[model samples]
Target: MGQLSRPIPLLLLFGVLVLAGCGALGPGFFADRSPRERVLLLDTPFYAQEDYQCGPAALAMLLAWNDEALSLPALSDQVYSPSLEGSLQPAMVAAARRHGYLVYPLDQPAALFAELAAGHPVLVLQNLGFSRLPRWHYAVVIGHDLARNRIFLHSGRQQAMEISARLFERTWARGGHWGVVVLPPDRLPATAGETPFLAAAAGLEQAGQWSAALLAYQAALERWPGSFGARVGLGNARYALADYELAQRAFRQALLLQPANGAVLNNLALALAAAGQRQEALVVIRQALELDGIWRQELLRTRQKIIADQP
Candidate 1:
């Protein structure tokens, strides 16, 4: 009997498991019928994937388009998973940051299309086989023709493979519709909201890319003036770079927005201490300690540092 004709209990069980796993996603795909038709075929370079090297290939394509010259083999060294015979998601994000690009996962189909419309190619994951027998593949979406219901991708050996939107959605749904976009430090993603953008910048800071994180924080401030989080992030990045005067200015601005925040006061005090204003730093640190919060230990440390700096 053919595979389809056989009563495969395993396949049925896998289908149930997949559905249950995706239950929290609520639903798949957009409900609107008339999505805006757009054709923004960005001049993004393409690289044919070799065996289980689609991750590196797709990442190379994105980095090349962002004006970084990197070979697939070099990227493979950074992201390739030897045991799994493929690349992991965290490795992909790390590789992008390593090449000085800001990478963020897209959560919505509309956001993916929005990035394409804004001349950014999106990398996505797809499962080409059944739920039980998965064939995971990575592809780059460069453009789409919504009127014809067709999407274009740089997949496998095809530089411009055209597939129906419905088919694309089905395959993408099997992989949880995972999508990501890479942006330069000064640039922002098309679907970038204030909160998520700030989070991405903070992630850069945590990754120890102080210069890139500083640029991202400055960009955030430009887009959202008086943003408390952006101000705090800017202060943190500047402090890391030893720009104490700028850090103090940014922390002071953040304090204005969120007065009584011990964390902000603590950071500001540290910046003041670093700038040689030991008396003022001691006063600020004392104020922070008086506030009942989780930053008491940090405030105490800053007080000790300020006292130590005094002659």
Candidate 2:
């Protein structure tokens, strides 16, 4: 999708210190229990990484689960860096977005389980070796069995590689606990928060995928109707698509949430102007200018444009 070009020597698939045996499968493995223990194993497809193409393999697996079929070779070409012998995280994210899929990060270990419980596979970065001598790798977490204290993964050349939850946490933490789930724009991650979800949607918008961003923003609004960020994002996406009226409606919703948010008012005024409501746009911009926010300068410029359009 031309989202990235520079090579990033991040995640690679190579020799990792394979622990002799799966550690103790007992509650003592790691002490964290939620309301109830459940076992969830997703039917995620596996694509073994050839050489250092773990990034493409993991991304392809995620896309396949999302029903967007893409060949490993094509994915490698898009995300793999031959010079670096690995794929950059940016390239992996961009590749997913290019296929109309949203990549949402699983910020914590809990978020990974949450996604798995919600029937979503998470692509994760791990340091298979010690922090001092790191062997960075990418893998897809397909399932988690709390009762068994094991996490299932489609990683490297293994179809159903099982690792103790304790080891998984150690490795994941060493890799900065980086994990992401790829899904359709309409779907929301089970553990999604308002700010992060809106930021992810904004990624699509910033990438110039306004339609996808609109769907993402709509999904965010469905989950959090009162989120000013979601509302503003929805308006921005609509505006980008040239749907001025709908954009104005979204901005209005945001204004209701925080009336004095000059940023929202600026957006509303801009949408009003785009819809040919010059007088209303001027009025809104004036209100925005009277208040104080980071958009004050933009509000002043907006007023100038609106007044300059008068007869």
Give the alpha carbon lDDT tens digit for every residue of 79-192 in model 1: 988788888777887788877678777856788878887888998988888788988888999987765667889998899899877778877888777888889977988888
Q: What are the C-alpha RMSDs, in order, of all predicted structures? A: 12.7, 8.3
lDDT of 2 by residue, 1-311 (tens): 11111111001101121111003224544455351265445578888889998889988998888778677788899999999888878888878877777778765666776777778888889989997998889999887776778888999999879998888888887788888888888899888877666666766765678799889989987898777777787888888777889988988987787888777777777777777787897888788778866667667776776667655
lDDT of 2 at 228: 74
Please report the candidate that would top TM-score against the real structure: 1
Candidate 2: residue 156 Cα off by (Å): 1.0
What are the TM-scores, per candidate, against the unseen true structure? 0.85, 0.84
lDDT of 2: 0.74
Q: Name the weakest run of 10 consecutive residues (lDDT summed) in model 1.
A: 1-10
Candidate 1 Cα outliers beyond 4 Å, as residue runs: 1-36, 305-311
Model 2 weakest 10-residue run by lDDT: 4-13
